[model samples]
Target: MTSERFDAVIVGAGFAGIGAAIQFKRMGIDDFVILDREDDLGGTWYVNHYPGLAVDVPTTTYSYFFEPNPNWSRLFATGDEIKQYCDDVADKYDVRRHIRFGVTVEGARWDDDAKLWRVGLADGTTLSARYLVTATGFLSQPRMPEIPGITEFAGRVIHTTAWDDSYDPGGERIAVIGTGATAVQLIPELAKTAGELTVYQRTPIWVAPKLDVRISERTKRVFARMPWTQRIIRAITDNIYETMINVGVVHYRVPFFRRLNISAMDLCKINQFIQVRDKDLRRRLTPDYDIGCKRPTFSNSYFRTFTKPHVHLQSDGIDHVTADGIVNTDGTKTVIDTLVLATGFDLWEANFPAIEVIGRDGRNLGKWWRENRFQAYQGVSMPSFPNYLSLASPYAFLGLNFFNTMEYQMRLMDRLFGELRHRGATTFEVTEQANTAYLDRMTELLGDSLWTLGNCASSRSYYFNPHGEPSLLRPMSTQDAITEASTFPLSDYSFV
Candidate 1:
């Protein structure tokens, strides 16, 4: 087949890809295409439709800064609402025209000779583009547990990512194999109908009171009539989350922040104390690690669900799955009708690159990351990746809100591409010196974060990669990220 060509090829049709495309359009770089493996856009919002699914972060802070939605029904929007927001954003920005859904990108290699990137697709075709942006979010890949007899089980298996809406768990014995963020949201819904529900947890997640409230129609109208009113709310919500991360997690080493972190833990304990009356069950549910070790979630129902007579928490760890049920490490067994795997994504191994990325000189992006360390210049550019960007790179995610990261990246794109245009260059890449300097600075800053200073040995958080480095989040405030994205020395990148 003939190779399709474009000015840019974005390897995701999610929010990140849409953001990139919008930025490209603003920069007058219109010849770009968005490719997604799913049948439609919305990325995770499009894919995951499990019960009790909602935005963990507040609705005001979850959306793009430029495009505010005043129609959110609640402070914490449901998954369907978020998905609709994605659709609305895409439609409003006209990014839907650039999206090609159900298109799987296998890999991409830098064509040094042609000064472009050759993106390989699953259909045995190739796309040539001057710029390549991998917007595949960190949570794109769903991970299945490495159980002994999961396949042999004679029951319906459901992953949170691919939940079977047709299969009802009402009055059925059910087993959920994880207690991550997804499970925290889903378990309560399962408890309402399941005959006997068991949650097999390896690590306990810290839970906090969800201050969720319904957004009244009057409030939404005020937001719609006065967009600035919503922006103010967004700013307030944004700062609240920023403080939660910067003080509770990133700056844990500080004497003052350390006390605040302890207080935060206590708050979660108080939340659990009120919801869970059984002390022993509460002990089983309580996390031993510090609050920020793993991402904490907010829920009014998660803790109370375990207090139900039909619900059970199995913390001994799963040894294997039998044809009828799961066998625990303590030789205990729990027979169930359905198995729900909330086992989160494989971040380091499978999702770091998400797809094969061969940069200049045949440098395999994943292999290089494993051999050395995961590093990206400002979480976007790499040393060997000319005219390429990965939105989901190391140190890219900021605070608890993803929109903060996306907004800053959009700024970086504006500055970088503006420079490219000014220099009349066709390619740009981060200099080796610049890449190393940024990586070293990030490492130094992370030394003060809770992941390094706090007892995170048992957290089992995806924040720590295979190398045992907490590189997923940038150890700085959202303001710092924005400043760096705008003011970083242009000399850090080479234009050619």
Candidate 2:
């Protein structure tokens, strides 16, 4: 309905997008606008309003490059609070007016000759830009289990992703499925109110206590006085994150090291003692796999919620959903008044939504991914697509806060942009051979990582590849990634 043009257009206004916008502004680059699918900012935060929805990572590290929040209240803020934080960030940076909300990008591709990207919106609108950043985020897609008769359920049903205030599960028999981070948080909140809560867990999850507390007034005053001190603290604590990556992937190569880490996890079962009063229930809460195998859950209240008298646990596969309730493989039918699905988002190769993106030589994304299995050189640029960058690219997961990673990525892209502009290049694209070389090296490095062992029998995690290996997440140390990111050679790309 409206036609406008800009030097660049960014997608999503969440952590990655906000950081990108802020960095772009600081770089003295103008003529850029951020577009979000929601009516407001906060990509995942705006959509997912499930009770007890909170950030698992520490609050100190989860912020921007230019500014930090003066009032973060809690160590790990809830979804609402985080959403408000994002809103506050946009407002603080004065990028809120530049943001175009309630629009979803349907298609985006390189225009080789024109040297601009033609991006189509959900409402049949189009805009062309010199640069395009797909900050659509990793957790945007929600995956509900494909069980028969899912639609025939008679009672109210809701996914944790789309939780709203109107829906009421209070004092009702409710089914909470999946025990990941979101489920871990929501289950505790639900146990306090729901008269009956039956959890259907397919696989066990490893959980750690959220060494979390409110931001102390004294500490806030210190940070407020000297903010660089906060950044210094973040730098020192960053090794903890890098160390976890080592424990996640490297410990598998050494059985003795793996044993030590597992023993350490076993020793941290003080949380189980505090949560589950019953021995059997406590055992059910504990995981059999190595710790940090799955995305390590941080919660002070998760296991404790199961100790409630009304809560029950069912650790079997669901057979099908009947009109009245769910039937498990063990022939147990859960007669529930309401069903709450915590099943994670669709997280596989097939889950990437259909989008029309024709790059050089009319190379489409679907075919590229289908043939090459969703490969990206450093998860930023692909073989055919030119002058495009994906935020939270593949293997971009940092064990700690990823905002810093996103900021680093934005910096890398700025460098690439600098090179492209100064060289008088029309378009820059990566060579196929370089892409293959990078992926080959990455796969070989992940052979002995925990993903290999952690993805073994009884594991149905999304990180595992088709060969049951955990190559999706890079096994290399974060130092290598940062080094590679900082020194991204132009030799990998071609200029038109």
Candidate 3:
């Protein structure tokens, strides 16, 4: 094994890591390496190859502000296209040289006296650095349901994240478990080929119409020529999304404005009712929970896929899995040839389970989060983890577009790093008091949002922790978050 040293180390090379590396290079900072366990980049996009997987958000706004793609073939790019876009960005920015593919960071320990972090790789090689940044996204780990006899199934089984490219599901009976975002996308594609498709849903999901189309050549040419035209479109998209958040969360909770929530629910019913002809199927597909309770989905084909004659939707809870098929609570079994698990990732816990981060006072990062609850100041820095940062931090999820939120976070990081450099500080850590104060404010603010006051628990969303705390979203707008990240005093942290 080989050991190397650097000024900093970045983990995971998807949107967050790639953005971080590009920003660092722009700042004239080198001596850093981006390490990804996969041989390729595009963290989630690289791993998830499920058919019909497309960006839920518009492609115009789903990109980096620094590097805009004027030639997006579709309004919402597919999984392969997005992955290729990430690759193109990396190539254009010359970030590949600094990327160490197929290297997994197993663990990291902070050396207090030496003021360095020793990050251990899976192969027993150690790389030391002054700062450690975890860009490992939330959706890295795919989860499977804990049903009895799941392993005893005789047919081929695969998680959507680990889709087998060579195997074809055409003319075969298939069972898809879980009806989350990934399921919604892959189901429609699988329906076209599978002789029979059984969708097992524990809870209903609210789905909106996906307004997607191929980008016109004229529009692409205009964007490539003017450039400002694309920014205008992006701004309009952002405003529309912000309005949804304001109306749904900020204003909907008011006594006089509760009608907005009702209207949203009515719209959901109408959308589902129009797509599904059967009343019973519509009711089963209709979510009892209020809108915004779960992360709402958007798809043009998902709800319509149910109208297919060969498709079956089962709402009953699974009793167990048999060698032939799955048994329902009512003692009915449905035979299948292939089983697809669409259950989401273990997100409440940090994404990197293998990497045990030992921070100040021998505090393990995962252990601290589990014991004390997950709280990070500005979704970047924690109290004990000095010089360590996480991009997918709790309370950091802001705005309709994830890329926009991440851009704001990277800007804050730039400022923080600038401060560290100016002061010649070896380490920077947020204070416990600051961390608690921010979390308290977030918790109090969320009391008025739908995710907290609405019926999110019944939604079975991963947004909430085991303690029933809605730890996913911030109640404030994206602009508010950007302002906080920008103007918040750096004095809240100690420079050592």
| lDDT, candidate 2, at 78 | 74
Q: Write the per-residue lDDT of candidate 3 for residues 1-496, one digit (tens) a residue.
A: 4378898899989999999898788767788999999999999999999888888888888899877888898988888889988999999999988998999889899989888899999888899998998888878877778999999999999998898999798999999999988898999999999999999999889888777889999999999999999999888888888877877865556865567777867877777877888888998998888877777888777888998999999998899999989998999999999999998888765463336889988998877877887778888788888898888777777746788778778788888888888998879999999999988888788878887667666888777776777676666787888888788888889998
Candidate 2 residues 22-112, lDDT tens each? 7678666678988887887887888888888788776666776566765677778777778888888888888888788888778886777
Pick the winner on lDDT between candidates 1 and 3.
1
Q: List the candidate numbers ranked by lDDT, top first.
A: 1, 3, 2
Residues 363-410, candidate 1: write the lDDT tens digits. 999999988899999999888999999999999999788899999999
Native-vs-model 3 lDDT? 0.85
How far in Å is the alpha carbon of 453 misplaced in model 2?
A: 4.3
lDDT of each: 0.93, 0.74, 0.85
lDDT of residue 9 for candidate 2: 85
* Steric clash pairs (candidate 2): 275-304
Pairs that collide, model 1? none
What's the lDDT for residue 190 in model 1?
88
The per-residue C-alpha lDDT of model 3 at residue 329 equals 90
Per-model TM-score versus the true fold: 0.99, 0.92, 0.97
Residue pairs clashing in model 3 are: none
